[model samples]
Target: MLFEDPVFASRMLSLLTLSIHAIFATLGVGLPLMIIIAHWLGIKKNDEHYLLMARRWARGFVVLVAVGVVTGTAIALQLALLWPNFMEMAGHVIALPLFMEVFAFFFEAIFLGIYLYTWNRFDDQRKHLLLLIPVAIGATMSAFFITTVNGFMNAPTGFQIIGGQMTGVSPIEAMFNPATPTKAAHVISTAFMTSAFVLAALAAYRLLKGAQHVYYKKALHLMMVVGLIFAIATAVIGDFAGKYLAKHQPEKLAAAEWHFETMEGAPLVLFGILDDEQNVRFGLEIPYALSILAHNHPQAEVIGLNEFPQEWHPPLFIHYLFDLMVIIGVWLVLFSFVYWWGMRRKWTIVTSRWFRRLIVASGPLAMLAIQAGWWMTEFGRQPWILRGVMTVEEAATQSPYVGHLFFFFLALYLILVIGVVVVLRNINQRFPLEQDLAHEGGERPWIT
Candidate 1:
């Protein structure tokens, strides 16, 4: 029956598209900042390697941006087609932030083009670095606007819904809704951490293959340092996000924590398989830990799914995914500390083969954590598309052909994923080694 529902089909398709799009989206938000940093460092140290690394990173960023544009356009179209009713009602409020996002995208694109093109043309390093400031700001602003819109969906404000229609719309207020701060901060911090780990993983892979180039070493060091800082920051922000959810979306938080009965001093479920009876069949729980984490007191009251109607409960599986995300976050935080400790002690860990392997492994793990975190967020907001405003069944298109469309888009995404991998691999292979650069008589290599 679920599979027969067009609403379910539409939701699945949207989730698939978002998951695929998020990889590039995070990178788009983050890689530009890293490039800017690399460029700035290059200028400060007169290091051609940092500059070259920045240029190469820019090429990858461009490819991802192109793909992001396609996926982003598809998402926009899906919103209109699949959720026309929701769009018609709240389009005005949503459009405000999205329109701002478009400007941000254009600003990023313009500065990115200028920065990439003027690499060889600009003899002045300061001017070249200055161009990247807008690129970083624009990219971050783009994410901020988009996340603000999503935040509005989670915690809508600035409008009254009377007689099934939105009225008294104040787009500015909606843009700065209660949920925006925590949501935007969490997303932006994860973007930077994800991008840093990706670059660090690449450097580790090269080092593992016996590449002793200073470029790889420096890249690894820089990316890991950035990654560690953001990774730690994300953990702290994640706590604030949890507190926000506890206060604003207690039911969703309950499902995520697997609190089957409302109680004080709730234990934090670590791993669990929930049954149809609303019971966690098997799991580990840290007694009183969730209450302390969520409310800073062991005896603090924590709501449960049973407090709401059965139909209103978010999917229980979100608990597992949420736990997985937290586990990965903890691992990354610990790894970052170890890496930092080694760096302070003259970088002794770089010589360890096991550490290099772990670094190589962290890339996919970071990606997994990012995806899992999103899964917890989106899926935890189940039964409602706009949280207390409209249900997914009300928002989804009535057309029965959505299932076919889902399959089509799934296939399309598969092709796009393969194409991206192939293109990026070829680009990586084409990058000139440090030895090649040394023999080139100081000629700046062109990325194109």
Candidate 2:
């Protein structure tokens, strides 16, 4: 038996469940925003292909968003039960944000339901276009509100703990936590980026297969443009976030870089083995990279993980996660830029087999990057539910039956995973071949 500490095991399980839950979250929060935007454009251009794609995407969004809501509700309840101390402290500190999140959720649900049902209700183009605005607005608000909760967790503002009881909580401080703006921008932009790439991948895959459809080509091109622009923009914002963390959370930056010395001109580790006792990543190095990244000066002193106590340091596993995210992010930017350039040059992308294969691969690559980035954030914040305020051990539920809780969450998520796959497959089947459409009798000329 591993004989892990109960608190540690609980934290691990919490991370696992939350991570799985959030995969649906990005899709839920992001897909709807893009769908509404595409739908609006479709209406404006009076383009049937755009309208068809939007309707198709909306259906998938409806199913996945429903699952996301359910899973998110579970996570919320689990948070309170799994860490009562954390709930007590954070509930008081960030109550306003949590309350506001409820409103955002309600807004999203209402607008999404309307969009799903009233596809043909509004004959007037302008009024129908107006419907998409609420959907986009709701999605954006939902994403921002959720990030407010996470930002509070990271910066832990809005309240003080006196003798273990929260006191003098301030809603404004919680909403405007130090991490609020940065984390919100980072998360929302990345969501947009992910949605774009995923859409592009699907469209490109069909186009490359010689589907002989105009719908797929136009959709892929637009999606490619959106994905490329946002992916690059997200990277720029992430760089700013990296600098902000270096200034405010040096330990996290150090752990991410696997730096072992607090010194000038620290070389970043491209790949190395961590010698925990010696407190260094041995073998390989990239000269002066850490110094440049941290301080914009090659000789500027950059702190290292070794400066912190062993118990306090984030695990090496999270360092690898952070690295994977960065590496994949770079690849996405490069690939997206090239793909967009090809589109500008008159859609050479569809004709190139190799490029088409790469496009199909881009969806999974971007998804992997998003997952790794989140792991870096949550896992990198180790031992602290609220950074510097409360340790994970202090906040963990005292019950030893956490194993049972873990299995329950595990089983629930497993069902959700199966449901998502089945639903997506059914949605995919909705977009049929022209031959299939012909076979269905020309009565229903519309693809739907």
Candidate 3:
């Protein structure tokens, strides 16, 4: 029945677009901070290497932001075209944050252009680097506003709905809903971690290829430190997020852990296959772990999906996705610690063949973890687009052509992906390496 539904087709299309957009969006959010920091370091050390790295990275950041904008615009259009009913009803309530995000986007774009264009124009390094402050803030604020809007969707507050109509709107309350803090922190932290790992991974790859230049090594070290900190922070913040879910959306918590029966001392299902008979097949669960994790006590009661109607239960497959995210997160933490330990001992961990392989793999693993985390959050909220307010079916457009549009968008996304990859590869090839520029006395040829 789901396969035959146009709503399902539209939902899938929208999810596809969002997932692809998320890659660029996370980079867009994270790269600015790194760029600004690199510029600061350059100014502090009076080292041309750091400045060159920052400028080179900024060019790539510009490309990512440009692509992000296009994909982001596509998502906005999809929301209206695919789920008009939901947008029409709640648009006003969510509009404030969305509008703020647009302003943030514009702000980021304006400064980014100026920062990129004026790389060598200002002789004062401090003055040149100052432009990146607003660029970083604007990029981060864009993520904050958009994430708050999503948080509102999960928690749904600041308004009264009667007979399918909203009234007594409080934009401030909606913007800073109960879920805002945890969700915003988690999202932003992951962005930083993702970007750091990605950059580190690329640099590590080059290192393994015999490009053992100081510039690459420095970049790798900087990104690794930042990535490790955020990776550890994400795990801790994730626990807080879990607790929030247990209190606010117990059914989602149940589904996430695959707890089918309501009882005390709920075991945490680590890996399981849920079946039609409400049993976990070939499952591995830790006794009382769910209770302790959710409420910090082994005896605490954890609600289960059976307590809610069949339609209210979230998809069970999200359990595996949640598990995958946790597993990868733990791996990142351990890997970071090992890398740090090696660094402390003055070991050439970055050049080690096996370690380099792991480092290169870290980027894709982090990306997967971020995607999985989102899958759990979005899919775990399933059947309802606005939590208790509206079912996805109620919000989805009633159009027979959605399936066709889905294919069209799929093709378009493929093209966008190819274009981005080619463009980024070209940029990397054209950009001068630190060794290449050292002979020129640290002068950048690209800067006019």
Residue 329 of candidate 1: its Cα lDDT?
90
Report the lDDT tens digits of candidate 3 across residue range 274-317: 77787888888789989987898999999888999989989988
Per-model TM-score versus the true fold: 0.96, 0.91, 0.96
Error of 3 at 318 (Å): 0.3
TM-score for candidate 2, residues paired by index:
0.91
| lDDT (C-alpha, whole model) for all candidates | 0.88, 0.76, 0.88
Candidate 1 shows a clash count of 0
**Poorest stretch of ten by lDDT in candidate 1:** 434-443
What tens digits encode model 2's per-residue C-alpha lDDT throughout 353-405?
78877878888787888888888887778768888988887888877777777
Q: Write the per-residue lDDT of candidate 1 for residues 383-437, one digit (tens) a residue.
A: 8889999988888899988888998999999999999999999887776575446
Where model 3 places Cα greater than 4 Å from the true spot, the runs are 1-4, 348-350, 434-436, 439-443
Q: List the residue pairs that clash in candidate 1.
A: none
